[model samples]
Target: MMNKLYIGNLSPAVTAEDLRQLFGDRKLPLAGQVLLKSGYAFVDYPDQNWAIRAIETLSGKVELHGKIMEVDYSVSKKLRSRRIQIRNIPPHLQWEVLDGLLAQYGTVENVEQVNTDTETAVVNVTYATREEAKIAIEKLSGHQFENYSFKISYIPDEEFVGAIIGKEGLTIKNITKQTQSRVDIHRKENSGAAEKPVTIHATPEGTSEACRMILEIMQKEADETKLAEEIPLKILAHNGLVGRLIGKEGRNLKKIEHETGTKITISSLQDLSIYNPERTITVKGTVEACASAEIEIMKKLREAFENDMLAVNQQANLIPGLNLSALGIFSTGLSVLPPPAGPRGAPPAPPYHPFATHSGYFSSLYPPHQFSPFPHHHSYPEQEIVNLFIPTQAVGAIIGKKGAHIKQLARFAGASIKIAPAEGPDVSERMVIITGPPEAQFKAQGRIFGKLKEENFFNPKEEVKLEAHIRVPSSTAGRVIGKGGKTVNELQNLTSAEVIVPRDQTPDENEEVIVRIIGHFFASQTAQRKIREIVQQVKQQEQKYPQGVASQRSK
Candidate 1:
C-alpha cells in the first residue's frame, strides 16, 4: 500500500524534473526524490490521496517528452484498486450530497466510511471502473462541502492483507532502513490484521526495493513453515518418567507450559506398541521456547533413564563380569559389551534394537546414507564427519599442483576434504575435515594415512594409524564406556582399534561429547559401528523390564 507511483514508458530524454513538472501541473506534490530508471521513473507522495489523484489524472493519459507514459500505483510494490479517497468532510455533509457530487463524474460503486481523529468524516469511494475513478479525482479536487474542503487522495487497493508484518513491526522497519524508505504501517485506516498494508514513503526506487525485501522475508517465512512441518519437534523420552512429567492431574505439564511458553503433549499410552517402546513428547512453540522446554523435558527423562540404569546396575552379573561404569570409548565409535549371558550359551539374540531393524543400532542411528548397489560390501552407514590431523609439512603434498590432488581425492572418495587453517605458524598438526558416509570417510582417511606414510612422516616399519573424532549425545557417553570400562575394552578386542573418551570433558552446545578413535581403517570403522549400535540400543530400549523397578520407586 505504498504511496509510491510507477511512471513507466518514459521517453529516454525525460528527466526527474520533467516528470515532477507533469505531476506539478495537476497540483500533485512530489513528497520525495523521483527514482528515475532506464525507461521509467518512480515518484513518491506523502499523501496516498495525491498518489491516487496522479494515477487517476495521468496513468496512460499524459505525455512526457513525446512519450505517453504509464502512471499509476507501483503495481509490483503496492496494492492497487479503482478507488478515490475524499477526506475532511464536515459531519453534517449528507451521504446523498456526496453521492451526487461523485456521480457527476463516474459510476459510484461503494463508499466506505472510516473513523477519524478529527471531527471531519473520511469516506473512501470506490467506482465501478478505473476510468470513472480517474474522472472523479478531477471533478472532486478542492470542491467545497459545507465548512470543509474535500481533502482528496488515492486509496490503494491491492491484496497484501493477512500477511505477518513481523514480530514487532521490525520487519517493516528493517525494509525501510535497508532500502532508504519510510513505511507507514500503523495508520489506523490500514489496520486490518497482522498483514497491515504498508506504504513506504521514500524515493520511488527505495519503495520498490523495500517491496522486494518484504517479498524475500515472506518467501523465507514460507520455506521455514514448510520445513517446520516436515521436521517437527519430536522428543523421544522414556515412558516411566512421563507420569512425573505430567505430575498429579497434569500439574507438572501446566508448570512446564507456564515456565517455557510452550504447549506440551505426550504420546498416548494406548498407542504404545512393542516395536516403539519410547514415548514421544511433542512440544510446540517458538524455536527459543521449544528449546527451553526441551531442556526441562530432557532433564526429567535423563533422571528416569539413570534411575532405571541404577536398578539394573544393582543386580550384578546382569552382563557377567562387566561393571557398567567402566565402559568407555573404543576404535571409531563402537560400543562393545558382551551381551548378557543368555540362557547357557544360546548366543546373543542378534542385538535387536527397538528403533533399528537394520544391522542393529550402530548402522541405523549415525548413518544417513544408503549403500550404493554393492551387495558384498558394507551398506551405506550414514554420513560422517571425521577431523583427521595430519603433519603441517605434508599439507603442500596433499594439496599439490594447484589443488589438483585434493580435488581428485575428494571426487574419488565422494567426500568433502579440506585442510583447516593453521592455528599458528609452528603448529605440529593441522586438521583435515573429511565429510562423507562411512565408506567415504574410510577411503578418504585411508588415503590421508597412506599419504603421510609415503611422505615418510612416520617410521618405515610403523603401521599408519590416525585418530578420528565423532560426537555422540552426552547421554550415550556412559554407555560408550560401559560399567568399569568394559565396552571400550571389548570394542578394542573386537576391532583392534584404540578408542578413548576424554575424562572430565564437558559436552558441547549441542549436548554431545567427542569420542576419539585411534587406529587403522577397519579397526576404527568396526569400533564406531559398535559404539553407535550401543547408543541406538540405549536410546530405544524397551522399558518393560524397568517397569517393575520404575513402579516401585516412590514419587
Candidate 2:
C-alpha cells in the first residue's frame, strides 16, 4: 500500500502553496514536502488511510483553475515509464466511459487527460506493467469511438527500421498479416527528427506478436545483407556459343561443375535481344571454386573462338552484317549492336493522345473534337460546351443569393450557364449547362469545381468527378432549355458540347427543380457559363424599368 498520492492533470498554474492550503482545508496531516511539477505533483500523507481519504475526497471533485484534478498513488519510475499515450479521444466523452474501457485490459494505475483541444483530447494512461499498456494500445488504437478514430504510436530507435522493413517491404507485410496490425514506420526526413516513430494498431495478442515478429525480421535481414557482401561473382557470355560450352548431354558442363564445385546458371532466353544477343552467367561458391571455374570456362571459349574464325569464310552471310570483332569472336571483348531499324519506307506512327486513352469523364465529354482547345487555332476559336451533374445541396451556393453569384461567374468567365429543371421527384441530382469558347470554358468550370470543394460536398483527398448538377425554377426552364430545344441545341452548337433538360420534374422546397450537366472539365465550364448568362439576362429584364415606372407614377 503506497502512501504517496500522485495528483495528475494539475494546472500548470498550480503551486505548492495551493496544494498545502487544500490539505489544510481538509484538516489532513501532511508527512513531508509537496513536490510540484509541470501538469503533475506528488505529496505524501502520514499513512495509507490518510492517502485514501485524500484520494476519495479530492479526486475529480476539486477544480483548480477550471481543470479537474486526478488523484492516485505515486507509481514507481519502472511502472510509470511503461505507460502508453492514447490520442484523438472525443472531447464530449465522459471519463467513466474511458476508464471502464481501459480497465478491461489490466490494472490501470492512472488515466490522465494531458492535452485537451477544441476537437479532441490526448490521454496518458499508465498501467501496472508495460505489457498491459501495450495490450491497451493494440486493442484500442484505430478503434472508432463515436466520430473519432484512435491513433496510437510508439517511439523507436532510428536504426531499427531498416531491418524491420526488409527488402522491398516483404518483412513488414508479413508482420502486418501475421500480427493483424497496421504497422507504420515513420523515418526521419529533411525535418531532422532524432528518432523514428513506429505505430502499430492491433489487438492485445496481435500487438505482442507484431513486436516479436518485427525484431526477428530485422535481425534476419541485417545478417543476410552482411553475408551477401562476402562472396559473389557475375560473368557475361554470348548466346550463340553458350550451347557449345554447355556441351552434348552437358558432359563438358558436368566436368567443370564437379571440379569447381560451383553452382552455375545462364540467364533466361528472354534476356537475349538483337542489340546484345548475350546472357549473364552467375556463379556462386567459395572463392577457390569460383577462381578454378573461371579458368576452365576461358579455355573452352578460346577454342570455340578459333574454330569460329576458321569457318567465317565458309559462311559469309551466316549472320547478316555480323562483326566478329564486335561479337568478341576474336580474343578481344564484346560490343553492343545498334537497334534494328524498321523495313524501308514505313509510315511514321501517329502521336499519342492522352484524353483518348482515359475512360469515364474525359472520354464521354471531350471525345476527339476537330478543334483543339489549346493554342494554334486555325479559325474563330471553336465554341466548346460541357454538362455537369451538381448535387442538389450545392445548387444554392452556385446560384448564390438571387442569382448574383451565377451572374458574376458568367461575366468573369465570359460563358453562358443555365440550370435545367429536375428530371423527377426521385432524382437526387440536377443538370447544369455551360457553353463558351475554350478559355471561358476553363474559367467557368474551374470555379464550379472550387465551389464544390469549398462547400465540402466531398473530401479534398477524393477525386472530383467532372459531372455536376443544379436546380432552376420550372418557369425559367423554358428560356434556358429553349423552344423545340432550339435554344439548347444552339447552346450546344455554340459551345460544341452536350446539353440535356429532362422532361417533367417535381418542384423542390423553393418550387425550383434539378438540372443535369455532363461533360469534360472545360466543356462543362463553358456550358455552365453560357447558361448563367441567359439566366442573368432574364433577371435583369424582370427587375429593369420597374423602378423607373414607379418613379414616373410618383411624379
Indicate the TM-score of model 2. 0.24
Model 1, 173-192: lDDT tens digits are 66667878665543353321
> Global lDDT of each model?
0.56, 0.54
RMSD of each: 27.4, 28.5
Q: Which stretches of candidate 1 lie over 4 Å from their true place?
A: 1-381, 542-555
Q: Model 2 scores what on Cα lDDT?
A: 0.54
For candidate 1, what is the TM-score? Answer: 0.31
lDDT of 2 by residue, 1-555 (tens): 013456777788999888888878987755356767677776655333465457557767889877898775454321223355566678888999999998999998666664332246766566765677768878997989988987653211122344567558787898888877877664322011112335455654564456445534433433443422213233445544567778998888889989989876666766443222344455556556655665576457546644543433232112222232221112222111100111112211111000000000011112111121232322225565556667877889999999999998898778898888988876777777888764565567667766765565754233245564555655466677776777888877655546776777878788765556555443454566566556556656658854432222111
